[model samples]
Target: MKHSGSILIVDDNPDILIAARLLLKQHYQRVKTTDNPFDIAGIINEQRNSDQPIDVILLDMNFSQDSISGKEGFYWLKKIIEQDANIVVLLMTAYGDIQLAVDAIKAGASDFIAKPWQNEQLLGAVAAAFSHAKDKQQVGKLTRQKQGLNQALNTPNFKFLGQSNAMQQVFSTIEKAAQTDANILITGESGTGKELTAHAIHQASMRHNQTFMSLDMGAVAQNLFESELFGHKKGAFTDAKADRIGKFELAQGGSLFLDELGNLPLEHQAKLLAALQNRQVTPIGGSKTIDIDIRLICATNDNLEQAVAEGRFRQDLLYRINTVEIRLPALREHSDDIPLLADYYLNHFAQKYKRNLTITTHDMASLCHYSWPGNVRELAHAIERAVILSEGENLDVSSVVGNITSNANSTNNPIENNNAYDTFDLDILEQRTVRAALTHYQGNVSHAAKALGLTRGAMYRRLEKYGL
Candidate 1:
């Protein structure tokens, strides 16, 4: 089924408002009616507060038969555009004032609708307005992505710096995904360079010159989710001091990187689904709906399938976002890349901390032996710490990675980790280990239980015993 956007009919005449609503009702999910020009602003504010934006405005040009200049309507239209430049405004004009209609267009009217309108013409104009809005949005999204990519590519930190087959495959994947507008879902443990991948994708796209904004979904508040994503009108809420634009609107011609997407609430999932489907957004407390043109790239450590099964996320939304899923291997799974990544980080830290440290064979072995639970992020931090704290030219392996290898060897089997299981004193050490791992990974039972060599469901039952 075709997605129907919301429409607003603004006319002083009740008959005209009724007619417009009836005509638009067939195409739009909602058709708001307002006869008073004075109440138009309030009506818009109401919609914005509700997180529903008015997609297209069918505004009557002339108000009060005594005032045929359309001065009031024109003034409001100008005000509306000043507030939101992307709104689709269709002017309604009486017959024989073709010059006025032309002037309205010049003054920011999207398209003019003649009085005593034909159904086809009105619908055609509305459809054209939607098309125009979408085109404008796409152009804006490209512009932003282009700016972000240019900045990222110009940075000295963008070199992939690897010779491994895994790294080679990642480079190839980045190159392939960059050339298209497909929605990308990147999954891996945190600190696995997902943001770097997103930036690389943006730089590789045709929109490398536009703005690229990244939003951390986990950081946003649940109650403020809609306002942050769609935007809000001034006076829409207590803290909505002015008309606020959402990420979708700001990312108008660029790529929108939604980091930690799995953490978003179900309410937000519905809103996100709507925006991606329609490519438009409404600000909080404001009546005008702005079009958005953005390539979306989402990243998360959480498994969305598990989220769906647990009813924490919507399945349909998952289908929409996972059009092109790229599962990134963790550092442990791709151990062959450790030496390469470590060398890159070592050199980076050595230069940054003004140290002349060199990695010895012993140092390399220590790094390769340890399991990096925190992935590339943990390794980078460890390297920086080592560089800052080391004294001589040769990197200090003992000081840098104290006990990392030793700890791994000792805890290779969860059942053998006497210290970790000491608190529980359980009859089943394996089950207790799985529960502890689940708790540590925050309900990511699969990943948590993986550390203990158990299946997800097995870990789930053990976690249940601990009242998790």
Candidate 2:
């Protein structure tokens, strides 16, 4: 018959405290009784400090013999609410004090019970109060979660642009997949707007207003993978300073976008697959497994089929993620969209840098003609560079396409050429590019990584590999 919550009873009569405590103790997990209503503040403070806060308070009116106004009860009721607005309060009054009890209820009391109350009525009232308190706590938790999500989504860059037939087909697929909870896997070359596609799906889904959290696998080190995805309790590890909520928990009741999925280690695939299969995750160094509800969307540039064949990736994990697959065409395949994309980038950069710049027909022709091996990302970077370096209102095509054409013509490999490296050796070119990016950003790893189209963790590994 015991309920889940604790209760506190305050009365001026010792007999009333003894009778109330004995009756309530049979139903509540913990029952505290006090004969002095003046000691209420101290008792509440002690409970608060102990972290075993009182859930409901049963306060009696008319503490003094001549006190029929119930002023003392009203004052204590206000004080209790001030101490903890969430705590449920029930005022106890005599039959003659019913009017005063009604006034107390109007002020702030959760409910009022006559002094000669039936046992069933008292139990039901206290149970209802306890339920109300729990509901308040849950609402507060969700409000904080929503605020955190809003702060995380402040980086407004979710534009999905492309009018080509391939892009049209991709959009069609996204529209169909957005209504359901099926797992989606987006496959495409780097900078082909895979993350943008994921965002589009999330926005179009029913959970659009909930949350859309993106986690880049390439940016997470292997050592910290479990903790990053499944969360960890305080003291779980040497560096776990506090209990942390993982991406799975944060994205609950919404969508979770796992970018660079191919970068996930083979050993960790089983762990991810298990969580997806069971719909639950266990935090590091924690025994409890928390249930999770989320729509999964994964993106990867790597050919997962080839990886599976080569034993570098698990086929089971791929099956779990690719229930619905969307493939994006590279920039070269959709060269017709170059003008639209170029104009978009031009306007974006112009607004960003607070400059007025126009793109000429000649510049458009040059951009369309070049085979963008780095895809849309490289083109955006080129436009940003032109916006920053150009002196006139018109964009400088020479500066924009000069090094691009030169590099493409100099190298035999188109991929290497698009990288803008003069050297033929790929390793030395990679090392040099990483070093240059780091230098350009003045040792800011995140900026350098973004400019180079690499994750921060990947850039760190490259820096260590080249001793930069």
Candidate 3:
């Protein structure tokens, strides 16, 4: 396998340099040789500035005749580390001794190798050094990211926002689950605060002090899936100009939240399964597999069981991610909390917009009575808009409820389902028709799909999409 690793060979003998370069180039993507050790810094600096930093250096211990002490190798090793602490330096010499090897290691050299090294031994040593270099680079990044994340956690925006019986059960589950290392799967409709729940779990876990990295599976493109989850070396792709850590590594000793998990393609699902099972990831264009430690949490609105039955999602991957599944009740199911949720958003938006606003007693019913098809998220947006238009007056119920009704994309309103079927909102109408067909067939998905002129897969997708 071709490795996306850069190796620099420094030696006074051109023959040693030539042999090393020829062997290394076959395995490594970039291999450069120089007979002069003085040019080491210049070459390293140039490459680092160009975003292709050298990962490993093969340095000869004796550049001058009768130089058996290996002092020159130690000097260069120290200098190389000073320039880039992540670079792994391997010292080689024809004068082999245990004391010299120990000194080389103490001086920060990765390994001490004798000249005329076996091909297998040389390859094994370089590969190990390259992997060590990558790990060092990633650890540096992880430190910065951890600091940033700690600062962010001090002022979080997502909140657990309900006290209804259904929600109280969810809260109780979270309380118990948060104390364990079990992989969690959170299932809910759009805008139902799935991510917020995941965040809550992270905060309550023992790993709360570390990072909580979130990756939106739906938003990530297919080509960049591996890089996003498993990192990439510089020059791995056109846009990869520098070594980059992935969500898994950044979330070391913490949690990784994979949002919209159902949207991940089947092929990528297999790749993810492999990584999850192995507890390691081989980065794109890099042969070395990095061990990962993260508490996995996946959230999705789609019914994964349906997808799995239809062969759209992998069953084994499902078993890996959902050690414990938490299904959040929809907003309509917990209508008792609507007024509380509405008041919270109203006060929040009013404070944010610097407005003196309150929901009128008469108008509060509209918020409680209507089905929040878009759930809490859509409610927050509606309240924010109403606050903007309140003009320091009472919030207009029309401004909030009217906006939700006019949004034909709101498919979960049972009240609207009873309408004259006269509206031109095709999305709503399609959802209604699908539900009607299911009801008529007593939930026979095949018959419902046949009546709607949809394939079974298409029917399953719609059911999952509409959360039927």
Candidate 4:
């Protein structure tokens, strides 16, 4: 097999440098030998700029003719790590200096090789070091992502709003659970603020200063599930052109919210369960298993118990994720909070549209009396639409409740409104909803898809089917 990585060798002995370069070049893609250790940093910077950075460095322990202290080797090793902690360094030492080699390992050297080492042993050590370097690179990348996500979480938005008894209970539960590292499972209908609940928990937790990563399990395809959640190395499979840091690693020392957990395929549930149980993940085409430390928070609309009983979900996985369950009540169940939620959305959208609009008592009552099947999300959307389309200081009650009241009086189902759909055909309903989302977002496919909770690829397929 042809190994694919750049290797660097640094030694004072010309013979050792030549021999090491020749042997490594036969296995690795690129090999460079340097007799001076001071030039190491310059070479690495050049290679990094050229996008061919060395993956592993082989360094001799001694430089001066009669010196056996290995001090120079330790100094250069520290330099290499300081320059790029992702680059793995293997220290070369005499058999008599084995203790020094151990010290080098403790000082961050990947491994060590004694003089007169067998060729097979040298090659094995180099291969392992290369793998270590790649893993470190992935970790570094994840650390950067964690930093970026922390910045994003600092933005002011998405407050959890409610004063009802049901919502008060949810707030109390979140306050209690936020201090612990226990796994949490949030159950609620779609758009009922399950993800918001998860976000609130993360922001309140001891890890609030760390990263908060979220994934919608339902959006990922079955074939990409493992790679998306557990990560994959370069060349792990077709089209895996580069190394990827998965959600579990990115959210290390923080919280990871797995939404739509019930939609995860049954066949793939075992893999997820295994990772959670082991608290480690092995990337595809990688030999090293990485330990993960994360507070997992999962949300699902489906009744997991029913899914487990029907064999659609793994019982073991459900038990693992639901260590402490918090269920959010649907909007209809807590209708008393409708006026507060509606006014909040009204003020939010009014400001967004730069409109000095207000909601009349009649319109507010109309919003509260309607049974919002789509929960808080639908209410928000309706208020936004009213704010945009209203021509006066008062929001148009007709525009806010036209479809809802008409459909409710006819069939007791607000979703069956003529604007969204006149019939009960699922395809037509989907088409209308997709069209409406596209319109709402001004034809931005990504925003439309996200608003509908569909992946961009899925949204594109629907658009093509409907010829939109």
Candidate 5:
């Protein structure tokens, strides 16, 4: 996280390499330059063995001298990923070769900065990439602590299932963003698979082999948030019996997912922004700042923009963390996928509960009509609950709570019916209703406002009111 850290600049052109080194020298204490892509592996190995692995690599994906569709760059990138997947690799490309940049990302490059890049963009990417690497290392440490030193190392390929459009979109975004150091902000209502999205992003990223750390900002106490995120030195405070690495330091070269970010206090947000901003963490009661590299992903049930407007969250911080924003649709929006989700959860819990039951038409009708207030998470829990309590071969709706029905009149679209709110939270129900309108019109605020029977200003006020 230190601005004075080391960077290795690799480019085929002496001019470009020199320029890169000079550009980095402003922030980095030691900037190593190498114009030969062929020598990259040797240089990286030597650095790794010396325990001073280059903190960042400014690499040109195409070498003019040894061009065969970037064979040279590809070889080095593969080798680097194989040697140490935790390295922060920022790929450089010429202006008209964006397709090649995308290919490099798929091949494991951490990020891509084009030729003729702005100084601020390059430095910002470097800083963010380095922080991502440090965070992965920190998460690895936590995984080691939670299980064993070899736990993450021994894990096999991950399994995440969902063919829903939202899930597919989520997967594609993660695939594209994982190779880069871009910060991700996932927004969704409670139970809409935000954590799962975070997990998928990490699993598909270059740091897939490392640890994945997650914590809910809303659940942690304000006083404990600091020590929890940034480790404390031994005897730093009461009950600080031994040294501990916080999540930021523990998730180095991996990912740290902050769930319910809207719940994070302003103080915690400041510290997080600083760690992200400076790429360095000052642990509680520790004078020395630890350099860290981390990929950050934050999820929230509350609307962050409103939080920023209300002065509860930092606007600059939001810009920093939300390079890519993914909004997850609630269960009702994608009701067509309910049967699939329900079947999946049913099979999952049925296996766990040792039940050989199947859902019936009546049960499916009940589920489809029930306006799932809890989204996927709630549905999964309901299925598991039903699985455990079922007494027959066919699962029914009686095991689950809440109203689910069979009549078309009973299943009237909440957006078109006022009666749907009879048994639901008016605030959330209204928000969902308005959000549906916004979606139906592709975010045309005025049209959505008209469809929802409100003025445009009223609609905006509601969004601001609910932080939607």
Candidate 6:
């Protein structure tokens, strides 16, 4: 793909402008030439407003005949940098003024080319300067992406939860797919490590040095889909106060992971599909289409094929994103890995809270045997609570899921009876479990709610329902 950059040449001689334009117009994405030095600032400002600022400049030292002192070039060079300090300026000097060109370099000029230049020399110099300019742009882009990633992840480091056979198969598929730019679709239940799996593929891929941008499709509002994913020009909408770079543009030359892809509204699916099909996207209220080179990775718990059959999703979009599909195994599917995952989280929580805890063989057995409806995430939270509540060095996760407290023999604890729930009454069991969670957490609603895999609002509704 051509680098997303523009170049400008300022030389008083019409012939110089014509020659530079003929050569550079083919190489750069956008090249502008003029015989007036005074137009520099206005052009720069215009380009800035368009969100496609001039990247490099070729300025002639002498606007008049027999004047190669380079005073004019130096004056314009300062003005150009004042407009944008990061801009690269290459000086155009007469053959006899090579020493003057050296002086120009010291005065903030990137490199100098003698008038009546060789084609190779001009192209090479411009290519080098443009590369340096792109590096500068990349640094600024990476800074923005860094801040975004920090806000999104919240946690310091992200790690896989286990080394089970199912996970090994995932790693193997990642190793193969990392070598290609094919679009990937990840299907898995919530907390099944879909994001981390996509991240692992990107880290092992060739574009690892570039940004790994992501968007949660479920969170984006229906009305803001276009502006959020395809960017927008300033004032495109009432809330678009400034020019915005969307997920597609931000993930240029890298990977874009669209989380909860199934939640995307049916009407907006076509827009996303079009961008992926054309490999380019136009911002809202912008006429020019920007070329994209993103390796798309999408994840969702929803069954997209079923959605498509039901007319809730576009089948064409599904085919576009799923060149390769990876379905993460649920915790129940790989129950043997529970011990490793549990131990890892136990040690992690122990260090985090400055608590020493050891899990018994019986506790480990319970962890492996139970059905983890919330997958690995539930296990981590459970371990954290165990570490916090354990008074002894030996860890007791006996109350991890089935109960809330270690008072297994308390006469008031109805569920602890050997014949508890003999009739398999779900309502009675749920009530006992809710009461136990509240009691264990000392009526801490939030903690109890999270322990039961319920949102605080849902917990409140249940509390009112059961009159607790």
User: Which one wins on TM-score?
Assistant: 2
Over 4 Å off in model 3, which ranges? 1-148, 151-155, 403-468
* 112-225: candidate 5 lDDT, tens digit per residue: 787788989988999998898888778867766755532453342223556778677777877888888789999876667888888877777777766688888766878888
Question: Who is ahead in TM-score, 3 or 4?
Answer: 4
TM-score of every candidate: 0.59, 0.63, 0.59, 0.60, 0.57, 0.61
lDDT of 4 by residue, 242-295 (tens): 999889998889899999887788778999999999999998889999999999
Candidate 4: lDDT over CA atoms?
0.83
Task: Extract clashing residue pairs from model 6.
Answer: 358-395
Find the 10 residues in a row with the least total lDDT in model 4. 412-421
Which lDDT value does model 6 have at 412? 49
Residue 447 CA displacement from its true place in model 3, Å: 19
Report the C-alpha lDDT of model 6 over 408-451, residue by residue, as the tens digit: 34554455543465546676577667767765654445557889
lDDT of 5: 0.76
Estimate the Cα RMSD of every predicted model relative to the unseen true structure: 17.5, 13.0, 13.3, 12.1, 18.0, 13.8
lDDT of 2 by residue, 1-468 (tens): 578677899998888888888889998888898988778888888887988888899998778887777788888888888878888999987844556766977989888888887989998999899998899788888888875775468234736888998789999999999999999999887667888898889888888877788899877989899999999999998999999989999899989999988878888998999999999999998999999999999998777898899998999999999999999887889999999999998999999999999988877887887776557876887788889889988988667556444444445543334455446777657865775665454444555788999877787677555434
Position 242, candidate 6: lDDT = 93
Q: Comparing 1 and 2 by TM-score, which wins?
A: 2
Q: For residue 460, what is the lDDT in candidate 6?
A: 67
Output the better candidate (1/6) by lDDT. 6
Which residues of candidate 4, in runs, are more than 4 Å off?
1-151, 154-157, 403-468
Candidate 2's TM-score: 0.63
Clashing residue pairs in candidate 4 are none
Compose the digit string of candidate 1's lDDT tens values, residues 1-468.
333666778888889988888878878787898876677667777877897766678888777776778787788898777766766899886742778888888999898877889999998999888888778778878867765665764343635444667667887887888899989898877656788788778878876777677888876878888887788888899988887778888777878899889888888899899988888877766666788899999998898899999998899999988788877766777788888887888888788877888888877887888766556766777777778878878877557455554345766434435465434446346544553564477444446767877765665565444223
Candidate 6 residues lying further than 4 Å off, grouped into runs, are 1-109, 113-156, 403-468
Q: What is the lDDT of residue 69 in candidate 1?
A: 83
